[model samples]
Target: MGGSSDVSRRRFLQNAALSGAAAVSGVGIARRADAEGAGGGAGQAVDPRSTEASGRVMNPIVPDFAGEYGGKVPEFQVPKRPMGKTGLQVSILGMGGFHLGSAAGQKEVTEMVAKALDHGINFFDNAWEYHKGMSEEFVGTALKGKRDQAIVMTKVCTHGRKKDVAMQQLEESLKRLQTDHLDVWQVHEVIYYNDPDKIYAPDGVLEALTAAKQQGKVRFVGFTGHKNPLIHLDMLNRGFAFDTVQMPINAFDPSYRSFEREVLPVAVQKGMAVFSMKSMSGSGEPIVHGALTPTEALSYAMTVPGVSTTISGMDSMEVLDQNLMILANFKPLGEADMNALREHGKQFCDGRYELFKSSLKYDGDLGRQQHQFPTAEEVPA
Candidate 1:
């Protein structure tokens, strides 16, 4: 087992302290049952306090894992939604494929994949260049016989007007994933306004993607960017329609660089599936900035409207189980819960983490491309 880091230790102590306080104040934390069945319309009002008054939150409805893991473990379910316009239903919790390639060994990767499947997660995300393709390889192997049971999404990054290169990447990905086609194939790391034109230009990547879809090599089409929402919106607003979009949508995001206010509403209006990333602020920068705890940050993201799912990177079963508990026990946050979470993270959003707002590290690939094709003087119509 991995040793607890200082941050983990701190989080445990804080949770224990908070639990004790709740006990003394008579504000009981909901057990594991009530949360599963408390369904209301989107944006429905929920009383946060009543959650405690309602007694234990219900445990997630776990599937039978007797022969698989040699025993039973708690199961968690996040809600599900169809990929916009594709009509493909996917879990609200997505498994990020980043660390699956980089940090985890083959056995660990297999176990992680098994655990996620054992739970209700069916949205598996990966990228072509992640761990130089090891991530996709592992996921492909893990989902070998179960391909029909899940939605596999992956991305490919290629340079200007290179449809051939893009197609090649997709073919390689298909080979590694051991699948005939992808459910969703995205143009990865899109960070600037002019990106769409370059992608959709004659002999550009979008042509390859369109070809893939027509040939049944892929199903839904989408894009992911970490830097700016304007860039994302600009890309989507251009002529071609996207089925889904992925961007950062945590508490620190709203006050400083909010995709929720600027881009998400548009996606919702367009009926595109909105997917959230960096809910835990990936590099732990939110924690360094004294923003909300990991759990609180995740809660805030889940509460945002139009978010079909939030992708969290879980490297261990403990992390996975904790997130499962949160999702399974989720009750729509009331005004007070939302206010408290927002207030707690307000100071950290004062542009201090603006590193996340710039594509500096992506300078070579995304930044250079942006320089080449700056957003035209006229805004995208």
Candidate 2:
């Protein structure tokens, strides 16, 4: 199993710690029990893509996460979408980098990447800081013979450092990813209050982005953050033309310090592709707490307006399979369903479930070190 699976379970445990509930995953993540009796009650394992042998629809979920999925869904490919004006096609399900690094080994990472590609998941998300370059290395090695089929995206973690630092990190990322150019290179984790000011400063990382594009080292440029929407707005309003922007997009976001409410429209208005992360409330907090089901959370993020794709953390083959099934059969939830989910998520709007915004749990150690803040261990949520 991937170590990220372990970490995810731990985070789920911690989140469920608040409610004393059991854990879930991309697979173990429990879905809603159909009011019309979809399957084995609320926690029944049903194939998400299509009907199973019992001629049952995959609507509900199984809380018994220890069991393997004994269901089968129809084979289908994930859909592609336009990535803003970059004119690049991106997958609705992008593979996350941190968990790619956390997989057991290169072989496991290769398997996951291959499965994703076979299903049309071309957008691979990564970072220069993930696993100290191990994530980039695994992705590089995995895409060795299939680089042309993937839209690889990685982030530079200057964390308010100079443009020189960003440029150096880009070089390292290219070397580690074994690529001549990055399809999308972004400014990683622009969460700090003064991050925008620092990035726009003379000789800042934005200069590195412009240089990378000018030098043919990267095809597109953007920024990402999971903290406040105000911070993302600050980045957007900085007068620089970004091709893409990423943020946390989930049901709870609408009720809390909502990036969906505050930033989604602005980016769409600016004609920028908006990539979503932390669809399951950064750690399946709501799922474990029995507020939102796994499918509901994933479906909601995938259907959020103006979102190009929902970037998910799939560390294991089981997780990958589950997410693929969800994507394969994905239909945009109706306006009423979407609004109902928003109302359902209102209870978690206090930042308890979304700890990435409210706490230090999802804060990277490298970012904290660069910012001179205490480690997550020192001051955890």
Candidate 3:
């Protein structure tokens, strides 16, 4: 709240709406920190604000967690893996940027990120559109002096329109994240049938992305989509190699539009890093519906062969500890184990469980027009 005050919450939300995200209701921003995790199940209420120092937000990692987590510091030992051929090693478990933005306060989100890094988690995920860029801004705060320790990634949701507009989006993201360049910059949410084609069209966002890479504003370029595996393949078949590809690689995904079945092989053949998310069905809906336990869902995703790293949204230290524990004791599921788990999840594999694949709810550009560049007067000097 302190550092981000330069852009008021009103402005943040207003810009968010203009950028294509509708306001989120029932976010529990008013909930008290001590009241976190009160629910015993999937619908359990999450504390929107961090229990960290109230209003003392924005700074690099401090040696103390006394002001956060009710005075308990999280500790864990995690492993790192190569993210394909990027030459960057990432923690087996990466932090999700969306849920971090959902938390009420900047201090809380920053502390969660610091805690994750303190415990050996080095990969931090973000997006320009997440929480009106508050997510990237918070990561910027947490990584202020410790940026080199983390492999940071964020996305752009430009719908593959104007190359200059997409370039502006990247510049805006860089300013929000307080970084001159990103470790990886992805084209976000390519869900439609023609999404890939648009990106490859003349003066498309891909032009800006590649030019940025050449200019050192971005080290790598990739694309992310959970809606359809075909869209993922469409991206690859369109030409222009990628350094990574992010997609849903959860337990139930094998049965639905199946990014795993359709896209994983292609990504592997291309020698691109396989980044997996929505392992627990994005927002815990599948786990809440009893499709699979969190461990089972995550384990299923991790052992899916060719996954560089599996990311899960963790809003609290409790969730982070549980995931770290899973990683520490993790043993890749054997073929039989994979088969049985997939079978168990097959029942709930209907598009209902994996809603992103069948609905425009997760598509960032559904009702919004392509983001346009501002007039010359609006451009910064």
Candidate 4:
């Protein structure tokens, strides 16, 4: 098990003290059973992708939380939507696993998991390379006993055409997540031009994924790429059945490479559930740069037609609360409003905004020490 550094340990103790006070003040946290159905009964390990399985009732948001938005606030439960033709019904707002591990400590992450389940958000996203596996480790710890309350998805970063290398990564991910099987396992960051050919090659990662599926280690398969919609389409074009497809869904997507325009329809045609990420322009910098308010950016992603869930990395309680607030009051933008937002987005859609596409910063590098992919003998025939 990965141990926290000295600084992290101190932070954990401090945060734990604060949490105890918060609990005493009546913050309205439901216990495991009432809030999340932790073990048996409502929380019994049903399909992680389905919300109806929990059978929890959504209470309406009290008027005090309405804030500046006047009039009746919508009911408060996180909404669930169908994921393509897959029998999974995912929560519209998913917890980004990368950020979960970035929390101050294990206690904080555990609290976030509990709170997210309490708020009805069930989809969680992670990747093997995130924080060098620390992220998955923390997620595993946080979800120690409440595994059934959330749909956990993680990715293997190797771009290898080798099944053994990919399978090794999958096994490592499973161990770190402390789960026997994953709800979803994805091909992470398919940004390079030849990624699709490599993935579809003989003895490729796809073969490994099929083998894992046959072994019941994974329930669903999908891929995520933000650099280009063409790459996303290429993966789809290869004719493999994908249960989910994740990409950037935001105010500016329609103006740039436009995953919404070039790829979303194709995924829909293939009956793949759409997962949205980078709504706040990946780093939340665009909001600071005045592109759009945080609420507007998030709402923009949530309203895109056919999106099953939009994931934002939440490392703090304040951010989680703010996002939940946005979801609680969300109303899809009308066509005219969407058009206007797109026009506003046009000014900022230049490649500079989406660095993951224009640069290699976000690419998953397994490092030189690891087995380099496409080894001479492993190359596609």
TM-score of each candidate structure, all chains considered together: 0.75, 0.83, 0.77, 0.77
Off by over 4 Å in 1: 1-73, 288-290, 359-381
Comparing 1 and 4 by lDDT, which wins? 4
Candidate 4: tens digits of C-alpha lDDT, residues 222-269: 988778888888889888888888898877788889999999988887
Give RMSD (Å) of candidate 2 vs. truth.
9.9
| Model 2 bad stretches (over 4 Å) | 1-69
Worst 10 residues of 3 by lDDT: 31-40
**Order by lDDT, highest first:** 2, 4, 3, 1
For model 2, residues 1-381, the per-residue Cα lDDT tens digits are: 223233233333222221211222333343221100000121223332221112221222212222223333246788888988889888877888876776679999999899888888998898988877898999999999999999999999998899999999999999999999999999998888988999999999999999999999999999998889999999999799999999988877888889999999999999999999878755454555544555667788888878998887766676676676566557878886777667656656789867778876677777787889877667745
Show model 4 residue runs off by greater than 4 Å. Answer: 1-75, 367-381
Error of 4 at 96 (Å): 1.1
Per-residue C-alpha lDDT of model 1 across residues 267-337, encoded as one tens digit per residue: 88888987787775554344322233344656677778788877776554444555565565566566666
Task: Specify the highest-lDDT model's number.
Answer: 2
Q: Pick the candidate with the highest TM-score.
A: 2
Relative to the true structure, candidate 2 reaches a TM of: 0.83
- Collision count of model 1: 9
Which residue pairs in candidate 2 have backbone atoms (N, alpha carbon, C) closer than 3 angstroms, thus clashing?
25-29, 43-61, 43-62
lDDT of 1 at 94: 82
